[model samples]
Target: MPVPPATRTSPGAKAPTRPPVRRRERQIGGSQRRMADLQPGLDFTNVALRPYANVERMRNELLRCYLLSPPASEIPEAISPFTVQYISCVLATYPRCMLSDGGLPPLVHRAQVQGQEMPRALANCFSLVRMWYQAVPGSEAMVAGMVEQEMERLAGKPPGQGDYILLCTFQAYLLYSIMIYFSPLPNTSALKYKTMITLSELACRTVRNGFSCAAEHSHTRPPWETWIVAASKRRTFVTMELFRIAFNAGRLLPSSVTSELGDIFASGNRALWEASDRDSWGREHDRYLLDWEDGMLNTSELYRPEATAQKERVERWVQSVDEFGMMLFAVCAHIRGR
Candidate 1:
């Protein structure tokens, strides 16, 4: 082999070295730093779950820096792409389908006209949360004190509740958490700590029960039901990531908790997710390559260095991920790039 060209140096100097991929520690969870035993359905109580200081820092940072900051002028590019992408996910999910990211298309109509009390109640509460943001700014803890109490009550509900109810409860806490951090309401100081605890509880509950109904294929379950599972899983994982990055708060969470996010399956196939009925979802899902037919992507595969080994296939999977899934992708990529 030919000798490699040597750099011409007049004086003694160190050779340049490639920079590191990360500095302090690999904060974002993907291919690194996960506990092996902390798989899904395990007893979360056994895990060493501890609250980190970063949650409050993030809550304040987002509220003061992002939400309460003055309106932007000049270029429209003032907004971060990540912020825009996340907003798209929120708008897609809320009011229309409160539980799943991007909202489930089939139930969007039915839930409006003939939905159950829990879902319907969610619809109304969702509107109030949205309206609170739109309405004139005021004090009083963002929402009524009773709202927090109700959410507390809902969260403590028995374990045997239906998937739908569990998901709805998860949504209420999530919505209230948003108001607690971002909404320009008074008394946030009072509810902030309580909200943080509730959030962790909700995260654990969501992980344990939210996607429990999911299946690997449509053969045994209807496309609609699986779609819900897929959306729920994706949303929950991304929310955890958002919590991590939004304040460096996630830095305090144990690797076991963070690692679980990657092990779960994320929904692929946007067409199927958006399919209005069983027939359309079946057809679209069937058209996918055998490997991706179920559209069940192991999320860990998403953050690996060789994640794009299958570029075209990966592209299809990335496109299929819902709004919150996209956020998860962005957060992981953002941290890894650093």
Candidate 2:
């Protein structure tokens, strides 16, 4: 999915609202100390959820960070590739969502699903409040505030309702945003104008804390791996899988940073297998193999022996799937209507 033209400080779009408060700077390592003393639990009782709401706001903040960040090819060696790869996942999904029409493909719709299931999966993946508190002790209050704000945004109130899936999506957005901000080198100054130093620090804190929590709880695997396991164990598992997909895709992103991007939708529901059909995603993923086998790949698009052949391939894929199919109908009725 191509990014909408109006993302950046659109003319007359509202300026970023001020955060609730700013406090005296913590000692450089205070947060780590606090995190060490925190506890881990399942309940988010009495926790405010406002900042977690306004899905659009969170999405846009991520977009600004990703699409407008420095080019990956030009990133100084001081930056870690893991961080860059993480952000790329965020940027990749927007186009994917639009193309797949928010994951309402024919095969996915055929799988009987209950509406609440998706949100439940999201909630499970993001309900790491306990881990977050303990992992980044000094930043607990601030993290809590951010969570509250997001929950309120989701609930359509000053303080929104919090859920697992929503938070997972938001986190996914964060990772993808960071990756894309540096993926390409399109006019550097125009894209790099936004200041991510603060957001980056916060992101680093959140991820590092998450890592620490995972380490304490499950010593067998890396934090990201542990997160994947936890999310999978939850009632809602799609969110974790989505993150997994993004992570895998990032590994395939070359240092060239010139891959063409477009939309490719998959299941938004947890019960459904994203690429159950061998025809679409599986085959498409496989094509990359052929591209590697032969140096004929022109950037990321398939080389057309003739442009007409390329056009036909697209048309066949599009025609095979219902543009106004049953799956899409549900999305419009349930997701869009919401």
Best by TM-score: 1
Candidate 2 global CA lDDT score: 0.30
Name the runs in model 1 displaced over 4 angstroms.
1-121, 134-142, 187-191, 210-214, 217-223, 248-257, 289-295, 307-312
Candidate 1, 204-269: lDDT as tens digits = 554554343324533334335444544554564455445433332322222112545555555444
lDDT of each: 0.47, 0.30
In candidate 1, position 110 carries an lDDT of 25
Candidate 2 C-alpha lDDT tens digits along 1-338 = 88878647879899888788867543211232232222223233222211212334333433343355446675422323554444344434432332321232121221112122434323322343323324453664564455434433433322122332333433433322332333322222211213232332232222221212222232222222232222222211222222322333444322211111111121122211232232343354444333333221121122122467544543333333332222322222232131
Clashing pairs in 1: none
Q: Measure candidate 1: CA RMSD.
A: 24.0
